[model samples]
Target: MNEEEIVQYFKCQLQEDTNVATAVAAIKTLLEFLKRDTGKDYDKCKKMMSERGELFLKRISMSRNKITTLCCPFIKDGAKILTHAYSKVVLKVLEEAAASKNFSVYVTESQPDLSGKIMAEALRNRNVPVTLILDAAVGYIMEKVDLVIVGAEGVVESGGIINKIGTNQMAVCAKAQNKPFYVVAESFKFVRLFPLNQRDVPDKFKYKADTQQQDLLEEHPWIDYTSPSLITMLFTDLGVLTPSAISDELIKLYL
Candidate 1:
């Protein structure tokens, strides 16, 4: 595939799965095999792509497990946790913690899609107490929550996170209340993005299809960027890192 086609394919994959890591894995596999495809027969090239795809999936799963394990300690016994949207990684962390710690979770009814119900249902199945609230209630319940933790679609170079639209509101409330706002994400979700604001986020992430076809004023953005200053820490497969750490390191290396 040419660069433009590959980029379009990646966007479609991401929108379908709602998982950046999986999308990246798919592209990585394709890119790695693209050169090999030029010299190999069709069957051989197909087999190579299949094998690489499986490896990337396994690695993604392993990293998620590692991140879950690393963040387990934060789910203290009887804690009142608040989370937004639906994050598989966040769910895994809570599930692992539920094995021992007794805690209740409050999830935002992330608007436009209302994915929080899915998260709540999943937790209920596991016997974890969960309360689903409207997106606007993030601050109303902030005082009752011990901490705010959410998942990310992307962790940008500025150390800010792009996640479900309501996340920034939750983060702001957390900061105002002096509550720790944490992000649970895999290292692969970290990208070399530098968004100055929510609008600065790439359209591919905010919209499900080609941006030029849509009218922004009438569109509901799928996600928004939360500033690094609002976050207390990030629990990633790589390790627990302060937002500044990501900025200092990613910028120094990538820039």
Candidate 2:
């Protein structure tokens, strides 16, 4: 499946899926492979699709491995790592780290949805020590954290990232405390768009709040942009890179 096909699937299903971005990225690789091996032969096309399917799975595996390999070094035994929201990649890295060294994770209960609680529970299930904190306590806990890791929704050309609404604040807190703030994302999440501010990102579907404060909630957005200047490094499938290098990598991949 290519980007358009995956997109169409979501449209037809009329449901929200968090994996849509990840799916789009995987299918994009398959589409690129088809472009390289263009031909009118049916057998050749079928063979290409078969190979592409395997490659797509391998790509996902590679990305997860790269994330663990690259980020684990930063997670020493007894390290306290803070993360916002829940990212599968981030979870995988934490699990991988736990297999070797002991570390504690601080999860911010990502408000409105409390996805952070889910993350904390998942880590506890994996036998990793976890502590649940309110979203407002990010700055208070920053002094105790060794590193701050997060997943990105979209990594823009400006080297900034679009992620869960509290990400920007987390990044700012990390920067203030001189802690390592890293974004673990696959290269496929890189996009050509350059967002100069938070408003540049299009609005995501508003999750209905069951609370009576819905009127006040309308002013808050689900995602926010973290400026590149605040980020310390990017752990990607390609390698560990500076935020400024994102533009160069994107050009090489697309152009």
Instruction: Tell me the tens digit of each residue's lDDT in model 1 across 1-255.
Output: 886687677777654545465767767776776756765576786799899999999988998898888888877899999999999999999999999999999998888888999999999999999999988888799999999889999899889999998899899999999999999988778789899897788776887644665566677788999999999999987789999888766655566
Off by over 4 Å in 2: 1-51, 204-219
Candidates' C-alpha lDDT: 0.86, 0.85
The 10-residue segment of model 1 with minimum total lDDT is: 13-22
Candidate 1 regions off by >4 Å? 1-41, 248-255
RMSD of each: 5.5, 6.8
TM-score (all chains, Cα) for each model: 0.82, 0.77
